[model samples]
Target: MSVTKGLVKVIKLEELKPQIGKEVQVLDQTIAIFRLTNDEVRAVSNRCPHKNGPLAEGIVSGEFVFCPLHDWKISLTTGEVQKPDNGCITTYETAVIDGYVYIGEPIQHEKHDPSR
Candidate 1:
């Protein structure tokens, strides 16, 4: 498939497992890519909004993933923290074509301190 101008090819669709999250690094940012059971693709920042948890290691349920550190439920589609939580992580636009996955430029957010 021909890649779009701003999207970077990340992985092949066959390389991703259903309901499993894979971490892809682009430039200096880490992103988590997910292929749901129905073959829909979603991408979000690998860092959790709370505690900077590694979202790639989180549990995937439907379109939401629970943060590994504190069980904060984050929507993979929208990157919004579920109710009772009050922050959001950046969500990247994704495209899948001819079995390849492409990620658009990520939305910029405050950088999280690694030492936290």
Candidate 2:
């Protein structure tokens, strides 16, 4: 992995398959990186809000991931847990630089949706 001043290279862009999640370590956090069918790369906390499920092992559908533990559908983009279940996870900023996947800090937003 390559390291820049503010970005941490976690994996290669080619190493991430579309619609699949890859587990990676950045600093002290476990992150789940996904390449969407549209080739959008997203990074989020690897644990599901509902039961602390390992999201990296979850299934990816569109922009959402179905938590492997209890089938909680979460939005990889906004980190919003879809309805029927309500919660949110930490979403990190990601970039593809020089064919490498780099992750930045957590997105500046409220992680938990109490209104849900």
Candidate 3:
């Protein structure tokens, strides 16, 4: 994956199908990428916050995806669980440039030093 100005290239724009979700791995994190009907792109955690369901396989309706496991509605834009559902998944910024889709920088956590 190529990183430029804090954005990591994930896939080519042509590789993503409109209204479909694609799962991608970045820095050991599973992220779900979506190409909306309007040709816009969105990125969020692949696992649902409720039951670890695979959001990539969910049905996309507008800006929301209904989790395949339990039918929990998740907002593709904000990663927020809909009413009656609790918690949220991580949302990543997405950009398409020169026919390539890019996501924001992955979260970085401080490493633990065993010798410390």
Error of 2 at 70 (Å): 0.8
Stretches of model 2 off by over 4 angstroms after superposition: 110-116
Q: Count backbone clashes in candidate 3.
A: 0
Choose 1 or 3, whichever is better by lDDT.
3
- TM-score between candidate 2 and the true structure: 0.91
lDDT score, candidate 3: 0.87
Clashing pairs in 2: none
Which of the two, 1 or 2, has more lDDT? 2
* Candidate achieving higher TM-score, 1 or 2: 2
lDDT of 2 by residue, 24-79 (tens): 99999999999998888999999998999999889999999999999999999889
lDDT of 1 by residue, 1-116 (tens): 23478888889999999988999986677999999999999999899978999998899999999998999999887788887776788888888877899998766656444458
Q: How does each model score on TM-score? A: 0.86, 0.91, 0.88
List lDDT for all candidates, in order: 0.86, 0.91, 0.87
